[model samples]
Target: MSELSSPGGEMRLDKWLWAARFFKTRQLAIEAINGGKVQVDGQRAKPSRSIRPGSRLEIHKGSLSWTIEVLAINKQRRPATEAAGLYVEDEASREKRQEIARERRELGGQPQEGRPSKRDRRMIQRFTGRNEPSD
Candidate 1:
C-alpha cells in the first residue's frame, strides 16, 4: 500500500508499472507502452492511461510475457515482495512461462554452443530448407 492511486483509485500506467517492479524505471515503462509492449484489456495502452484494481494487463518483455490482474495500486516503488502483492499473474500465463522454461532446459541449456563456421552455416541453412542461390 504505497501512497499511490489517484482520488479515483486509479494510477498512471507508467507509474503503476514502475511501482509494481515491472520496469526498472518510469522511462522504461513509458517506452514499453509506446512500443506496444503493454496492453490493457487487450488494447494498446499509453503511459498516461489510468489503471485501477482488477484491471488486466498483457505485457511482453523479450521472450517472456505476462497476463496479470491488478490487485492493488502503489505509487511508490517498494521491495520485490511488496511489489509482488500488487498484482497476480494469470494462471495460464504462469503455466505457459513454466512450460517454455522447461522446454528451453530440455533443449540443452544454451541453444547456440558457439558461432558456426561458413560450411556449418551452409549445412544448417540447407537442412532447414533455406538454400539461397549463390551469385
Candidate 2:
C-alpha cells in the first residue's frame, strides 16, 4: 500500500491540510488553526496536532465550511484530484456550501471587473465629490 494510505499513519494537522489542498500553504493552515478556524472532533486543534485516519475535522473559511473525516495521510502536497482522496466531506456541509455559492451568484453584486476606465473614474470622483487635478 502507498504510504499515504497506510492505515495507522499519523501526520501533523497543518501538513495534512496543505497536502490535502485545503490551504495553499502550511503557514496558512497554521494560521487557520491558531485562529480557531480549524477543529478536530469539534475541538480546537493546534497546527502540530497529530491526526490519523478517521479523525473528524471542521474547517471554516470565509463563507464556506467543511466537516470532513480524514481518510489518508500524505506527506507531500499533491494535485487537487489526488488530494481529494485524503478526506471525505460530509453531505450536509457540501450542500450548504453549494447553496451559499448559488445564493452569492444570484445576489448579482459582483465586484467591479477591474480598475475603472478614466471616464468611469471621473464619474465616480464627481459623484463622490472628490475632484483632483485631471491627468
Candidate 3:
C-alpha cells in the first residue's frame, strides 16, 4: 500500500489540514483551530491534536462549512487533486455548501471595488444624513 493509506499512521491536525489543502498554510490551520473554527470528532481540537484515518472534522470558514471524514494522511503538502484524496466530504454538507453559494449568487450584492468614488461617497453621506460641510 502507498504511504498515504498505510495503517496506524497519524499526523497533527493542523499539518493534516494544510496537507489536505483545506488552508493555505499550517499557521492558518492553527489559527482556525485556536479560534474554534475547526472541530474534530464533534469537539474543538488543538493544532497539535493527532488525527488518523476515519477522524471526523468540521471546519467553518466565513460562510462556508465542511464536514469531512479523514481517509488518509500525508506528511507534506501536495497538489489540489492529490490533497482531495485525503478526505471524503459528507453529501449533506456538500449540498448545504452548494445551496449557500447559490443563495449568495442570487442575492447579487456585489462588493464595493475599493474606496468609493467622490460622487459615491457624497451619495452615501447624503443617504446617511451625515453630509460634511463643503470644502
Candidate 4:
C-alpha cells in the first residue's frame, strides 16, 4: 500500500531525496540543499526540513531542473522503479527536460578540436615512452 496520502507522515528533506533516488547519498542531498539547488513549496529548505505528503519540490542539477510533488516517504532506499513512485514530476518539468535533452543532442556531441597541451603531451610521452627509438 502507498504511504502517500497518510495525514501525518513527515520526512527529512535529505532522507527523502536519498530514498527517492534524486541523490546517490544523503551527503550529496545535504550539499545540494545547502547549495540552494533544492527548494520546498517555493522556498529554500535545509537538509533537515520536514516534508510531508503533497509538498512541492524544485530541484536543479546541472542543466536539468525538476518540479515534483511528494507522493510517499520511504526511509529505506528502494529500487529505481519503486523510488520513482515516491514523487510525481510535473508535466512542464518533464517537457522542459526533454526539450533540453533534444537540443543537446541536436547541437552535436563532439567537443572542439585543439592541440594537446604541454601536460597532455607529457602524459602521452610518458605513455608512449620518449626513449623508444623509431624503426
Candidate 5:
C-alpha cells in the first residue's frame, strides 16, 4: 500500500533538505533543487522528487558540498543532532571536503572573508610577481 499510494508519505527532496538542516526553509530547498544545486542518486533532482530510505543525495551550496545516504524520512524538521541521524555521509566526499578545507587553509583561508583594499591588492600583486605594477 505504500508504493503508488503513498502521497510522499516517506519524504521529498525539499522536505528532506529542510529536515536535514541544509536549508532553513522548504522553499529555499525547492529553489535550490530547481536551480540544480540538489542531485538525487547523482542526477539533478526537483524539489518534489520522492525519496526513500537508502537514497543518495548530493547537495551543493556555494563552496560547500555534501553527499549523504538517506536512512530515514521525516516530514518535520528536527534538531541538528537529530537531523544528522537521517543520513550517512559518503566517506569519499567527507574526505574530499576535509582535504579541500586543508588545502584552503594551506592556501590562506578563503580570501580573508572580506573585500581587499587597494593596498592589499598591490601588496599581493607585488608579492606574487604578477607585474611590475606600472613602475
Candidate 6:
C-alpha cells in the first residue's frame, strides 16, 4: 500500500491530467495547457486551474481531442482501465476518433494482403493514394 491521499478533495487540472495518463508526465500536462491544448467547460484555462470531480476537460493532442468529465482527483498514475475510470469520454468525440482511426487505417500505407508479384514490387508507387512506398 502507498501513502493515503488527501481527503480535502480535488487537485490541480494539470496534475489530474498527468495522473489520468492523458499526458506522459506533469511537465507535459503543463506544456499542453500553455500550448493551448486544453480547455475547461468551453473556455481556455491555465495550468493552475483547480479541477473538481465533475469538471469537464477538452484535451487536444496530435490530430485528436477528447472531451472527458473528471470522476476523481487522483494524483497517482495507474493502469489504462483504472486511469480511464478517472473520466468519462464524450460520445461524439469518441465516435469521431474512431472514424478518424478507421479512415487512416484504410487509406494509410498498408496494402491489402492477397499476393504481390515481382511487378508489384517494381512499380508499387501508387499503393495508398500516395506515391510513397510502404517500408
lDDT of 2 by residue, 1-135 (tens): 255555568999999999999999899999999999999998999999999999999999988999999988887887888888889999999999999999998998977798998999889999989898456
TM-score of each: 0.74, 0.83, 0.81, 0.78, 0.70, 0.73
Candidate 3 lDDT (Cα, 0 to 1):
0.91
lDDT value, residue 5 of candidate 6: 35
Q: Which one wins by lDDT: 1 or 2?
A: 2
- For residues 8-127, write the lDDT of model 1, one tens digit per residue: 378999999998899999999999999999999999988999899889999998888999999887777889988888999989999999998898888886755789989988998899
Q: Best-fitting candidate, measured by TM-score?
A: 2
Q: Provide the lowest-lDDT 10-residue window in model 5.
A: 1-10
lDDT of 1: 0.88
lDDT for every model?
0.88, 0.90, 0.91, 0.89, 0.81, 0.82
Flag the better candidate by TM-score, 1 or 2. 2
Rank by lDDT (best first): 3, 2, 4, 1, 6, 5
For residues 1-135, could you state the per-residue lDDT of candidate 5 as single tens digits? 212222224777898889889999989899899999989998988788989887888898878799988877766676788778778898998998898788888988555668888889888888899856565
Between prediction 2 and prediction 3, which has the larger TM-score?
A: 2
* Backbone clashes in model 1: 1
Model 3: per-residue lDDT, tens digit, 1-135?
Answer: 246544468999999999999899889999999999999999999999999998999999999999999988888787888888889999999999999999999989968899999999889899999887566
Worst 10 residues of 3 by lDDT: 1-10
Consecutive 10-residue window with the lowest summed lDDT within model 4: 1-10
Identify the runs in model 1 with alpha carbons over 4 angstroms from their true place.
1-8, 108-135
Residues 4-93, model 6: lDDT tens digits: 233347788888898889999899999999998999888899999998877889999999889988877667887777777778898999
TM-score of model 3 vs. true structure? 0.81
Off by over 4 Å in 6: 1-8, 110-135
Off by over 4 Å in 2: 1-3, 110-120, 125-135
- Choose 5 or 6, whichever is better by TM-score: 6
